[model samples]
Target: MSTPAAAAVSSADGVAWDLADLYAGPADPQLDADIARAGERATEFRNRYEGRVAELDAPAMRDALAELEDLSQLADRPLIFAHLLHAADSSDPANGALVARTAEANSQVRAGLLFFELEWLALPDDHTEPIITDPAAGRFAHFLRKGLAFRPHVLDRPVEEALEQKSNTGSRAFKRLFDEITSGLECDVELPSGPQRLNESATLALLHDHDREVRRAAARALTVTLRSNSKVLTYIFNVLLQDHNVDDQLRSRGHPMQARNLANEISQESVDALIDACAGANGMVQRYYRLKTRLLGLEKLYDYDRYAPLEQQDGRWSWDRCRQMVTDSYAAFDPRAGEVVEMFFEHSWIDAELRNGKRGGAFSAGGPADAHPYILCNYTDRARDVMTVAHELGHGIHQYLARDVGYLQSHTPLTMAETASVFGEMIVFYRLLEGSRDAGERLSLLAGKIEDSFATVFRQIVLTQFERAAHAARRSEGELSTERIGELWMDANAPMHGDVVELTPDYESWWSYIPHFIHTPFYTYAYSFGHLLVLALYATYRRQGPDFVPGYLEMLRRGGSASPRDLVAPLGVDLDDPRLWQRGLALIGDMIDEAEALAAGRD
Candidate 1:
């Protein structure tokens, strides 16, 4: 049942990541050894520092931070391995069990360490400030300073430990089940070759098919499957929404995203500004789709048609080609980044094959600082697939470079995390667009870039808005029915498309399949924040050319060592200015302007 596109992309079928660096497999004795050792260390840590955080001097605090970092790595190693295994194939009962066991273990270690943070939070600002500023504290200064932001939300040690322990069976269980159900879904699509059962990722990729009928069938197939599973999925969302609401209440957050914003090291006003800027430019979305409609010679565009190729001869690149293209793009930008991208392939660090139970979407996991990061993606040989590689490699490069910052401080907040990834995509995209052989190819490439940006910027806002609505509705109206949730999804999405695209009834159930709502509430806005920030950063790079390279890499190297504002200020970008966000949006507008001119044969 493999299509020509599928057959052509078979090079990726052999590209599974080698996780030996973490452990040989589930049976590896080192996994248990590490877990047990971490538990013992956690106990010793509690015995030594549980009630002593406030009394520790700068040097002692520095030593304590180093011990905690090592403890975190030991705990994270097995948990991350289990997560990667489960993401690869959740259908395996052992994989699911491993996930559960490691999660419980992680929670136990975190619970035992709860008193350290609570006692630290108890210190007066005068007592903590000098210690935070001490050079002896080293990179732990930012780590300690960041902890103070959560002081207002810290609960009693017993209460904190109780909540952490209970979550494994509560919200965590729901999230695992949601992943299992969604990843195992099979959509029956009636292709010209007859009915074919496709996994969630393959089925979703069909929306970009050159054939309208195939796209229609794929859309219907997805809706049918989602509707069949809507009850459990809707129940999952409701439970998670309530769980989030309870957490919000316990943490004393005023709004649904307040905690998320705080965790992102950003303020509510800044998120609002990013949302407002994207929402204001929604006209650009409608305009681009209208242009697509004309280009496709269709009387009306639908949700499915939004991603259709403008021509039949869509480019397809094999795995090797994609590897070369991405590395070349990065190398052209900076030789050092290019070397990191090459290392991902030379070493078995990327899992980019199509497997039955593999998770949909893509992510770069910073597995263990002692080892290295890993990338998970489904590469289908489409042109966009090339950009996907570039995107994830961007994250891989960022994660690889940030390892020197240590485990606790290496990972950036969600808002700034997408910077390197989006910047990587931009470079690859411009490379492809510049090399286009004709006006038609240029138009297609330009349109694809614009849509990708829209997906990251405008569509993410719609998702965040839908999350806000669902959260508010759950608070006010109790558990929402599937139909009620679908209405909210449509309301949030319809504004972006305006009258340009027709959203059929089948599109209603589509929201149920998104993992973000169930796994991480309000996580979508980070995409918007990162995309806009990168657009502005990419602009700075274009202006300064080679000079921007060192500062940008250094920013990634610093990782979460400082606030996001401090991290990017050296690059000449301000996180606070709404005008900066609009500048990014203006770049998207310029893209549309170029696409329109190309379509009119003016290029």
Candidate 2:
């Protein structure tokens, strides 16, 4: 196990990430210069090889792929910069405008490069296989294979370019509008103490408050604020939904979600099985919520009390304590994992301040393949916030390990993307569990981990079903009113609760705020996929003991260099096995069983 190299770890004081490594700031003149240079490079490449990528021999093919990778990195550097800036402060018009410009610039460059993929895909297997399969192709094999997978649904080059160009002003614009409205929202929750003015992050943090009244106040605050903005958000969602429908239609896809399935490199059977497995286990969601209700002394759980904490003490976790807990947890798992996480702390790669206008939720976006990835989260030091750090850092560490694979191959499908993150979180949860000697604290720890699992597994899969229903409704019934969308949500989600909890009308527009539904249709399933994938992977880690660390690390090291099935086959796991998912779900059932035993003793 790689150990954390001896060094001075710093204070966990809340800090903004220093993007000086990427650029001085948004207005840095070099940004424009880089964009201009990238544009010139794109033109040069187009002029050199526009209708001719497939004609190149093995060595030339390697060079072309290498050159294309370099060109891509250059072209998107500004866009990444803009993306990070907007994530830090979505309410800023300057950042928003920069985002649009960068998107359009990226589209133009992509349009120029479309012919390369088109020609590559156009080649017969006999013509292209030798080059793609060559040992020298290295990581590029999987990249090319993935590119070719889209051959079945690819449009003509001109049409593809047209869609790319229109996206900046069309769907992309609507997404930005959604972001601005949400980021600008300020929820006023009247507490017993007084009125608390909350940003999205703070308001969300209150949902887990030990006090039921505070949780209710926060939930309603979010509902009222979002309901006020529903008209515009509703329209934006409709346009984006129709946009996806039109894209799928023009691509001649078999259904609304085939494009995403292809993009994820997952078969429809595997995805459907995963969804069905989770849906069938909806009773488990109810069971867990029922446990939560008994623990909280409630007759039943309202949607507001879904995340309410069992502990009544002020759980204001210090940022410093969070850092120590996560770092130590990673170290306990493997020094190597800790070492990678330490690099983020030492180099200032995290953005964790809870400033107004910052994007809600959290993410870890990889920078240029050679540079470190950046993490963005609006941290409020809640216990959940620590898990959020662990989660995002999992992504960071994964990106860090996979960096050597180069940009083109460093991108994992969303299904596998959550592997490191969820595992990282589990490491921390286990560490916390192991350290807890008191039964009450242990119960709290176990319940929190279980709830997190449900959020990832059952909750996300439910969200995916909601997406499917909403898409079907929009396509068959014409435009859906906001009320109609809420109905779709209730119909899809109510069953997951299975009478274990209550769903209020507020949850209707709740779907409206989920960025995934707006930005990436069918992306929700991956969380369910990833969560269960981690549990299965963690089981292997347990059976093999420390011996499993290398296999796990090697898996991360391989990154997107191989298919998901091929990637896990070496670990003695099968992505296609129906029993694999059931085993993972069974583990969750086991946890609940133990929790019940503990609760019985407590009484």
Q: Pick the candidate with the highest lDDT.
A: 1
lDDT of 1: 0.90
Candidate 2, 296: how far from true, in Å? 1.6
lDDT of each: 0.90, 0.85
Per-residue lDDT of 189-305 in model 2, one digit per residue for the tens?
Answer: 777777767777778888888889988988998888889898998999899889988888888888887988987899888889998899899888788888888988998789999
Taking every candidate in turn, the Cα RMSD to the unseen true structure, in Å, is 1.7, 5.1
Lowest lDDT sum, 10 consecutive residues, model 2, at: 1-10
The sequence of per-residue lDDT tens digits that candidate 1 reaches over residues 442-470 is 98899889999999999999999999999
C-alpha lDDT of residue 364 in model 1: 92
What's the CA error at residue 308 for candidate 2, in Å? 1.2
Where model 2 places Cα greater than 4 Å from the true spot, the runs are 1-14
Residue 236: error of model 2 in Å?
0.7
